[model samples]
Target chain A: MSLDYLTALIAAVLFAAAPLILAALGETISERAGVINLSLDGTVLFAAMVAFAAARATDNPWLGLAAGGLAGAGIAAVLGVFGLLLGASELAVGFVLTLFCRELAYFMGHGQARQPGPDLGALNLPFLSDLPLFGPAIFRQSPVVLLSLVAVGLVWFFLMRTRAGLVVRAVGEAPAAAVARGLAVTRTQFLCCLAGGALGGLAGGLYSLSVKPGWGHPQGCEGAGWIALAIVIFGGWKPVRVALGALFFAAIQVAGIALQDVLPGLSGTLFQIAPFPVMILTLLVVNLRRSAAFREAARRVPLLGRLVPRTAGGAPGAIVGALDKGF
Target chain B: MTGRTSSLARAGFSLALALCVTLAIVAAAGAPPLTTLAVMLDGGLGSGQAVLRTLSALVPLLLCGAALCVTFAANLWNIGVEGQITLGAVCCVWFLRDLGLAGLVPPFLAVPGALAASMVGGAAWALLSGVLRTHGRVHEIFSGLGLNFVAMGVSLWLILGPWKRPGMASMSGTEPLPAALWLPALGGRPMSLWGLILAVAAFVLVAWVLNRTFFGLTLSAVRQNAMAAERLGLRPKRRMLAAMALGGALAGLAGGVLVAGLYHRLIPSISGNYGYTAIMAVLLASGSLRFLPLACLFFAVLTVGSIQLPLALSLDSSLAGVVQGVLVLTLFAARRLWPAGNTGSTGGTRNRGSAA
Candidate 1:
């Protein structure tokens, strides 16, 4: 590929990764707080529909985004109310909400389907857009892309550097200890779920208002949430790593599109679903590193020991423990 | 209140709430609620043909619901059941076309061969997720979801590329199988008595195994406390895998029935969201075999009935899903409001497991 084309493709990948970055980071916050907000896939679709409809009605993309964020937060609130306060299973509630919100979005947004709406376009940074490569790919993009980049740094800083982040981590680690520390455990988790949900919703809004653009049934962002969820595991739940994971996934997606032309004989649907199996394989590899036999083999061989990175991170202790307890 | 009475109260309350909310939604959407109901009734069960359609739809719902009961009993979320059904259908088509065709297999044996292939396909698919859950340290939900997409991709590839209909590549699905390979249907109707018998028999057999068999008790033991079950010499992981395989086989049967009895071809949406819809029904049933069949029938009605909403009321057919979701959510809310007492409760009383 030519340099200009390569630069453009790089920029496009960055743009495509924007929504996933937001959603994954959002999920990272929630999971870090020991809540699995599995309603993400439905939340994205619902948010996309709401964002598109609101933007069309008000003719303001920002309002559309805010509306989408609210839509996401609302779903999270339902999950929290059922899963946390009422002591229902998070997986059940989240799974039900995912399917429910999807059909509800389609049902309610039927009228708004295929309607034209205002889209958020790229804001060209005068000097940056003219830069050799990095400028166009990084700076000369929509605000949502910039927001996603900012989100990585911001989430990392919030989780690692802040006192509140410490409290969140502490609560996630041990709910009883958090209670002893006078940290409102449920409240903290609820707030984190809401925040994560808002981010997921914004990601959806970005899809409709910027990334994919326009509203329709079978919205292009249907399976994006599940992929984001997988990316979280692939990234080991670190903000920066998760952002990188999103970018990597986006690159795969872009490559799929590019490969469609090169291998015209293959079906397009095959290209579309290529990343799902890749995600599963990555999850298997990531998890396999922690398995007993893998660790044993790694220990027996000096070279293998060096090759296998020390298992620094797995699921949060409380999430794993609680889920295992089936409570 | 006794657990049984409280359960009945919750069910009734949830039903009332679901009805109120659905009617309100229909009225708000500017369609007369009563008219919508009547229209859906007419569409789903107004005549012999419509009843046949509903019954055909019921076969998958019952089978998928039965599949879910097994997995849910073991506390495994087999969300990949949707993909299992798709794989099953693909396998059925593959068997019928490749082996059963060109006089390789007799017509009488072809249908049975396709069914067996579908069962194996589904069981293998579920086992993959089960293995991932037990050994790979991957959560079944994520693995299941990922496999679901991959299964869709595989089916799509088969339909559009290798299995495309003669002279045309289309999203409409693959070529229809020969008549001899099809499940024997009621005279001139699409509904098959054999499919109905298989679905109902499978459900009843599952219910018996779950309620009476030692294997079912062990599964319950594992679900209740896997650590304790393990200490008691029960192999929790193996039981979980067994549950998943059994569930996958039944789900695969549903797929086979879809191809042989209903559609006679592998379509893009062959599963028709039945797996997820079955999940909702199973949730409402809340581990009780008694309510599960009713839940499946209720959902089957809503699904088949909602088909004519666009034509009759200019409303989206997805209203069926909205209603089902509301009903389940209301049940959850009701259970929260009125927690069942310690006595006279079955598996439904547990707040420890994943679902209602």
Candidate 2:
């Protein structure tokens, strides 16, 4: 393949990765603080519908993005109350909440099926505009991509350098330790979960206002939330790494689509099944106790590296500090 | 939730509030106002045929709900009842497809064989999830969920592939089953004797296992306090799998009966998300096996009311899903106020306690 092929590949990867990037980043924050919200799937559908409706009403794509994020956060806030304060199990509450939110979106979005949302126009960077096929695909998308990168930086800084982020991590790693050290465990968890919710909402906005705009069906959002969840596990609870995992997942997804073009003989349904099997396989092989090579590779694979660190002494500050530098 | 009194009044209040909220939604959908709800009540409970239809729907829901109760009691969250139902339907269809054998075996013999196949299929399907949870360290909730999707995929492939009736989709199913394999109608009634017989037998068996047997006691112990149960030599893994397997088998049997007694051939939409709906029923009843029959009646009424909207007001049929969602949310909210009575042994009080 030529450099042009490389350009096309990167562009496709970015296009595919954007939603996963936003969703997984949100989930990373949520899970990092020891809260697992399975509601991302439902949150995505509702937010997509909300953003679509908002964009149609105002004809302002930016408002749609805001609406989607708010919609996503609205569901997340419900989860926060039950999980943080009511002391409900995160798994059950999150799963059930997701089901309710998805149904709510389906019920409400019934009428808006015909009217497509306003699409956010493309943004082309001045210097990067001339980089062949990759330039337009990579640089000339909506501002969501740029914002995702910025959010990654901000989240990385917040989680590692900031005192509040430290408290969030403390709560996740050991709630008892955070409580002993004067951290309000519930409050930190609430903050992380809600932030994750907002980002999840933003991911929905990116879909409705950018990719597949105005596409309204019963389940048009279709499995993106589960993909986001998979990305988190793939990234192992780190923002930048989650982004990389998003890219990897995006690549597999894009490949499934791209393969249909080259090999029409192979059933696309079978190809579509490939990623899930790959995911199941990857997960099966993960978390080994005594494999040194697996441990080393896992620690160096950027997002996956977050799972197993390579520090010899295992010092807390030093390890987190090393993670901080890596990001 | 434990050590707190005052749950009865709270649960009662929440249920009423939820029902009222549902009434309001129906009104907004341009159905007749709150007063017209009486018409719905009359329609659901008034006419003999309407009542019979509601009972027909109730029969399967009752069986499924009872089956669900067992799993929920053990905290096992078996959401794949729909698939088990589908698989059971397939097994029944399998036996019926053999035209020569169908003539040889009498209806009584064939019916039991079909029921047995269904129960076994359902049990094995559920047992796979149980095995994964017990040995593979995977969470049962997600694994069960994944199996639900897998089951759907298999169902679609079967219907669209091998089981695809020549005019099925055009007519929407296989050629209707021959009368020989059909579930026998009750004495001088339109309802199936099998429906009543199977439902009653199941209720008796579940109640006996849950309330009478040592295994029943052990299962509750496993649910209430897994570690303490283990300390007392009750293997939680085995208890949970048994509970789920039992739940799965009954759900599957319900699926078979639904096919033989009602639809007779497998269609893709046979599930109607009933397995998931059973979750609402199980939760609403607080997994009390005794209350499941009543919960099924309430759900049957709820289903009739929701179904009336499409013909009566052009409302989408998915209104039932939203209503069930509302029911589940209310149930949890009710627990917040009332403190789940049976759940006293659960929660932070027993950090070692678990649901399946």
Candidate 3:
């Protein structure tokens, strides 16, 4: 491919990766706070429909985005009320919410299906838009992509450098310890759920208002939520790495479509399912890396030691311990 | 007896709440709520044929629900049941075509042979997920879901590539099996009594094994505390694997019925979301066998009835899913307020505990 073609492909991949980056990071926030938002798949679809309907009715894309964010937060609030407050399992509540929200979206958004609606326009930054390949790929794109980029930086700084981030981590690692330190564990968890859900809603809004740019039955982004959830584990709950995982998945998607053109005989359905097995294999590798045998082998070899980090990151302690204590 | 009455009353109240919420949703969507409900009821059970359709739908639901009961008894999620069903149908179709068509198998043995192949196919698929959870350290939920997608891909490939129809390949699925290969139905009707018999038998077998057999008690013990069960000299992993195998076999049988008894061909969506719906039905029953059949019947009616919604009300057929999901959510919420005074509720609580 020519350099121009390569640049455009790269730009397209980044653009497609924007929503997934937002959703994965949103989930990253929730999981880091010791809550697994399993309703993510349904949340994105519902938010997309709500965003499309609101934007179409009001003729304002930003309002649609806000509505979508509210829709997501509202679902998260239900999860919290049932999970933390009422003593139900968060996983079960989230699972039910997944199916509930999905059907609700389809039932309520039927009329809005395939109807044209307002969408966010591209942002062509002045000097940056005129620069090299970076300009066209990063500067001259949808504002949602910029939001996702900013979100990565903001989430990283918030989780790593801020005092509130420390409290969140402390609560995630040990709710009892955080309680002893006078931090309200439930409140922190509830707030984090809301914040994470809002981000997830924004990601959904970005789809309806920008990326896919319409509401429909399939909506073209049906399983994106599950992909985002998987990306969180692949990123090991780190914001930057999560964003990278999203970008990588988007590339695979684009490559799948591109491969169809080269291999004309193969059915397109084969390519559509390429990411799932890859996802399973990636998860397998990640788990294997943390096994004792792998660490011992790394210790014996100097080169392997550099490749395998001394400390293997794990899930938040609160999640495992909470499971241990039973619902 | 009073506790049973109160539990029944609570169920009635939750059902009423679910109905109100569904009707309110319909009103909000600008449709006449009562009319829609009546139309759905009429569509589902207005005629003898419609009831047959509902009963046919019930066959798969009952099988899958029984399948889940076994896995849930052993405290395994088995989310990959959907994939197991798909693999079963694929194997059934393959068996019918390769052996029956080629005359390698007698006409009398075609149906039974195909069903057996499907059970093996399903059991193997479920075992893959079980092995991943046991040895690879990957959670069953993720592995099961991943395998579901892969299974879907496999079915699609078979439909469009190797097993495509004679003239052209399409999403409609592969060539229909010969008449002799099809499962027998009463008086040439679409509904097969054999499928229903198989489903009921599976449920009865599960109930017996879970309630009376020594293996059943061991499964319950393993579920209560895998660590404690291990210390007691019982092999928890082996029991879990056994439960998954049994569950997969029943689910695979459901798929075989779908192909041989109902659709008469291998389709991309042969499983028809029965596996997921069965999961919901199992949850609604709260791990009790007595309520399992009732839950399956209710869901079956809604599914079979909702097919007519678009024609009658111009509404999407997903209304069925909306109502089913709402009812389950209401029950989940209700359990918080009205904890049943029976082991049924205790079983539900214990299942959630093991989910952690």
Candidate 4:
């Protein structure tokens, strides 16, 4: 690939990475707290429609964002009540939430399907946007990109340093212990589950307002939520690493789209299934070695040094808390 | 939950609970409480045909659902029942493509061919995940989920590309099968006798397989505690794979019956979320063999009722999907309200509805 292609690829990757980064980061926190919100995709779809409708109805981008957050939180709250308080299986509960939210969203967004909204405009930096290959491509991207990066940093810092983060992790590590130690397991689970759903929803909103920028059709939201969940697994539950996981996926998707222009034969009907194949492939690859082999493989990568945790010197523990205890 | 509560009372309580929750939601929507109940009941059960059609709808659902219970009992999550059914129908269409073949062979051959292909499709699709979980040490849920997307893509590709009916422009779908390939209506007897008998047989077989045989006992043990069972020299992976394969076959059979018995041709929407619909039934029937059919019929009624709610009230018909979701979630919650046996953790509940 030439420099121009590389530039285009990088730019596309950054843009594509935004939604996944936001979503995966959200999932990491939720899963870390021992709650797997399987409703991510539905949350995204519902929020996207609501956000688009609000933008169209009120003509304010901020209101649309708020509407998206509210709709997402509302669905999340329902999940929270059922899974946390009522003690339903989180995965099953989230799955049901997705169906419910998607249907409700379709109903709420019925007439708005053909309509458009006030799109989220791009944020063009000053002199930075004028530079050669990198200038216009990276510097002139949407604000969602920068916001997601900042969000990742914030999440990482909180998870690593904050007492609240420790509590959340503790809940996942041992809910019974947490409860025994005076922590309100129910309340923590409830809040964390809803918050996860809400964030996933907000990310869905960003997709609509910034990426697609209008009412979506059926299957409108697509599998971004699943991708986010995949990224969380791929990243092994770290904010910075998860962001990179998002970026890795973003790069592949951009390449897949761009390859359509370069080599038409490569972009056949089968390429539509690329994400599934790639996801399955990555999952297999990630699980290939025992913990020791994974550590050895990570040790050789220089730039990825920071991405691998010190614990990576030992066995890697991924897919943590995917299931609830005593289920 | 208590044995003190009569079986009749427990059943009544659940139905009433469902109705009360549903009516409360309707009331919140500003509809008159009694009027909504009447609407739901009329739409669901007022007419004889309506009730029969609902039962008919439950036919395929029960087929795939009973099949799901078999696999779920062994802790396998088979998410490709929809595609398997499509494959079965596609196989029948392919078999009867040359109209002369339909005239040449009896419907018996056609029926087995359709059902066999679906079982193969379901088994192969599930086997991929089962292998990954067993050998690759990957989790079944993610692999199964990934398979769902792959199946959809393959289905879309087949219908839209190679299998595209000639000269059809609007959308891609299989042409209708030749009539000889259709499952006969039981010596010209009506009332879906063939389908009804098959469904009943499926229910009985699943109950027997999960309860009667040594294999069934072993599989249940595997589901409850793989590690402990493994120490007893029972191969968990093998059992799990067998369970998934069995699940796929059952789901595929449902798909087969649907095509040969009802639709007579496979359209792209063959499964139409019915696999997930089975999930709802499975969730409602959690841990109970006898209650499975009851839950299935109740699910059918709720589904049919929701479809009619819009005509009965000014509510949108899509309320059916929401109600279905709520039913699963509510039943799951109710299950948790009083946790029962510590049978096992890996007792994978069929989201037959993913339906969960």
Output the number of the lDDT-best candidate: 1
Residue-by-residue lDDT tens digits, candidate 2, A1-327: 887787778777787678779888898888777777788988888898888888888889899889999988888998888766766556556766776767666656766766745888788898786878767666777666667777889989998899888887877766666677787877877888899998998888888777667745554455678768766765657778779888887799789888889988554445544554455334334423113665677666867665553433111221121111100
Q: Where is model 4 more than 4 Å wrong at Cα? A: A1-7, A131-135, A174-188, A216-219, A261-270, A290-327, B4-49, B95-107, B168-172, B185-192, B304-317, B338-356
Name the weakest run of 10 consecutive residues (lDDT summed) in model 3 chain A.
Answer: A318-327
Per-model TM values vs. the true structure: 0.96, 0.84, 0.95, 0.85
Q: How accurate is candidate 1 locally (lDDT)?
A: 0.86
Question: Could you tell me which residue pairs clash in candidate 2?
Answer: A241-A303, B74-B356, B75-B355, B75-B356, B168-B172
**What does candidate 1's lDDT look like per residue over B141-206, in tens digits?**
888888888888888888888899999978899988878888988997989999999999999999
Clashes of each: 0, 5, 0, 6
Q: Model 2 chain A — which ten-residue stretch has the worst lDDT? A: A318-327
lDDT of 3 by residue, A45-154 (tens): 99999999999999999999999999999888888887777667776678778877887898899999989889999999999887887688888988887788999999
Which digits, one per residue and each the tens of the lDDT, describe model 1 over residues A216-253? 77888988999999999888888898999999999999
List model 2 lDDT by residue over B52-167, tens digit each: 76777777787788887787667676767777777777776777666314476675688788778878878887887777666654445545665665665566556666667775
Ordering by DockQ: 1, 3, 4, 2
lDDT agreement with native, every candidate: 0.86, 0.70, 0.85, 0.69
Write down the TM-score of model 4's second chain. 0.83
User: What is the CA-based DockQ of model 4?
Assistant: 0.38
DockQ of all candidates, in order? 0.48, 0.19, 0.47, 0.38
- The alpha-carbon lDDT assigned to residue A45 of candidate 3 equals 90
Relative to the real complex, the DockQ score for model 3 comes to 0.47
